[model samples]
Target: MFIRIVKMSFHEEKIPLFLDNFHSVKNDIRNFPGNNFLELYQDKNNPSIFFTYSVWNEESDLETYRNSDLFKSVWAYTKAFFNDKPQAWSVDKLESLP
Candidate 1:
């Protein structure tokens, strides 16, 4: 599986709106075909900075999601609140330790 990580920074006042939207659609994203996991993380030093960590069965699965209506809608809403351009990366797992 490949891991997808996205870092986003929102306008301070818009964080609540972004979070509410996330909560409303997170389940749909997590259950999407070929998705294995989904999680969200906030930076300790900056409340407006957040990260989305997800796992996909393959890169094509990620591409499919990106082209879906769900992604388009969510991205449209989320991007409106951005303080900066979002950054994303897809990487292979090196190791995992319990």
Candidate 2:
């Protein structure tokens, strides 16, 4: 399995728009073929910053999603709300401590 994390810094003024776009994002991924799980997080100290935690069957599944039209549309809208470039990382799921 692959774990993907994305950290985004949103513009204060664009929070509403970003929230609307996130609905679409969530719906899209929820129905995707290889998505395993997803979670959204926010920093208590920084409301404008958010993180997405998602698991996929493989890196190729993520790549396919990223290259899909839905991602393009979502990303184009999403990019406008960022205070800084979004950062992302992918890793192999090695062990679960629990």
- The best candidate by lDDT is 1
TM-score of 1: 0.99
Question: Which lDDT values do the candidates have, in the order given?
Answer: 0.97, 0.88
How many Å off is the CA of 89 in candidate 2? 1.0
Tens-digit per-residue lDDT, 34-89, candidate 1 = 89999999999999999999999999999999999999999999999999999999
| CA deviation > 4 Å runs, candidate 2 | none
Models 1 onward score TM values of: 0.99, 0.92
Report how far residue 21 has shifted in candidate 2, in Å.
Answer: 1.4
- Model 2: how far is 53 from its true place, Å? 0.8
Query: 1-98, model 2: which lDDT tens digit per residue?
Result: 88999999999999889887787679688678788898889889999999999999989998998998988888888898899989998877678896
**In model 1, which runs have C-alpha deviations exceeding 4 angstroms?**
none
